[model samples]
Target: MTDTAPASSPAESPRVIALVDDDRNILTTVSIALRSEGFVTRVYSDGETALKALLDNPPDLAVCDIKMPRMDGLQLLQKLRETSALPVIFLTSKDEEPDEALGLAMGADDYIAKPFSQRLLIARIRAILRRSALVRGAPEVENDEQPAEAIRRGRLEMDPLRHQVLWNGQPVSLTVTEFLILEALAARPGVIKSRNQLMDAAYSDDVFVDDRTIDSHIKRLRRKFRSVDPHFGAIETLYGAGYSYSDG
Candidate 1:
């Protein structure tokens, strides 16, 4: 295990992100990048080594590679989900849509393909950290003026502050991206939001994700809700326009 502290002054406790990968180069480079951004990091060589530490002393979030020696990222995520809701971002090989889809369905917050840009990863890290902070009751740097209120539309209830979602009174687990997308739609029931609009809502201005990413997230969101309520159909898809939420 390699741990690196933030480069910035310690005014408050810096957010901790665990990096799990078999490649030594990735661990070293990503750790340096995160440290420079004032984020403390802990790196593990494989998922087996990572799982114990991750559960014992959970980080704010984790960035894990899908392919590893002993335990794979998918197995690790499955085990982690049994006990924790810790945010996770998967690192996958390019064109591995099945793995990406599986990871999202298994509760990964997001994924970036291998040979990815460090800037994009950082942006994603910051995004997930911000959402995790909201769930942990940490003060949000953006939109502090706006109240963090619980949103209720028919059988769907979302607590932005707690980052909790309930369908028909049963709790449903959602990744940060899923939560943001759902929040945007449920915030205004019956209003259609284009793919671009949903992307803007879920990701930062600097980061770019394709339409399929949004569609995949939407699919996972519906699956999650349906897991709790078999008749869940609040989210409506318009053939060529976009998606809308209809509580009625």
Candidate 2:
């Protein structure tokens, strides 16, 4: 005898992911990953089978390889976009800037080149899915109802939702490392965070990385801020204590 739920109840539907790639290894790897993430994947070696499935029922997202026989990824993307507004990402062997730009122009939300780290790939996937979820009948994100907006200082405004930092009424581009460092320091105001603490917070699980790399990245970031203004002292270093962000 087996215990069963009521037959009138319905089972949850997994997120459908349509993946198009010719490589068997890639298809298998992607299917396994998506499945682990509660995503139901349909993979096709060629563009034909994938296109038919997409026409029958669109997937939540698509991760496609650019170089494929019969119909290339770009062509398939074009065909899909003809009628659907589904989100798509392109994985390409070509690392050329123009190739990436072309994929972006062709409606790819993001483009990853060959030999990418699987962990980074997962992060990208989550980011795309989060964005898609927000766009599709859902709010971006919500915390407890008792919180206010982020702390602001000087001309810099931090938007954690969009991962953006506006400086002097203009958006400034910062790498992931830079953004995290800025956020951690900016939130503390006058409180100085030691380099070790920053390394722990920003690069917690990061291995084989040296503290000098942090210094190097900060140097580059400071150089970029130098372009903003000479008198601008957004990030202040406290001799040996660490760094803090302030307008004064």
Candidate 3:
């Protein structure tokens, strides 16, 4: 494990990003890139070591590789979710679509295939951090000027400031991406949002996500809501079109 502390003081500290992967080259390369962008980076060679530090002192976000010795990204994410909501982005092989889907289903904020560009990775990191900042109500990073008021749609309720969601009055846990997508739908009940539109709502313009990425997130959203209420069906799919929220 290697830790790089930011030069900034606590009062003006930059965001901290944890990088977990067995490849030393990736650790070195990504850490350097992140540091250059004013981010403090902590790199771990494996998942087990990363998990302990993650729980002991959480970072603003984490980028983890799916395949690793000791524990793997999936296991680390599973354990982390038990206590923390730290934003995570998975690193997967280009051919590993199943793993990407699994990682997203396990609550990853996003995923980037291996051999990724530093610019794309950095863009994704910034995007997730921005969403997280909004959730935490950080004034410096708050891009939206609108009020962070709570929104209620039938049995579903969302508190943007608190980053809280409820179904039938029961709390439901959602990742930053899922929360954004759901919010876009619920904010305009019965309005169908195409995959591209939904992607725009949840991701930064510079970061491109395939249609499957949005589809996986939608499935995860429905699954989470269903876990709270077996009959959960507020999200509707329009064949060959997109998805919409139905409070009625």
**Against the true structure, whose TM-score is highest?**
3
Write candidate 2's Cα lDDT for 126-197 as tens digits.
665654443232343343321224547878886654556677877665544465567778877888888887
TM-score ranking of the models: 3, 1, 2
Cα RMSDs of all predictions? 2.2, 10.4, 1.8
For model 2, give the RMSD to the true fold: 10.4
Per-candidate clash tally:
0, 0, 0
List, residue by residue over 37-101, the lDDT tens digit for candidate 1: 99899999989999999999998899999999999999999999877778999999988879988
Better of 1 and 3 by TM-score: 3
Model 3, range 197-216, lDDT digits (tens) per residue? 99988888777888888988
Question: For model 1, what is the error of residue 228's alpha carbon versus the real structure, in angstroms, after optimal superposition?
Answer: 1.7
- Every model's TM-score: 0.89, 0.51, 0.93
Error of 2 at 136 (Å): 2.1
Q: Please say which candidate is ahead in TM-score: 2 or 3.
A: 3
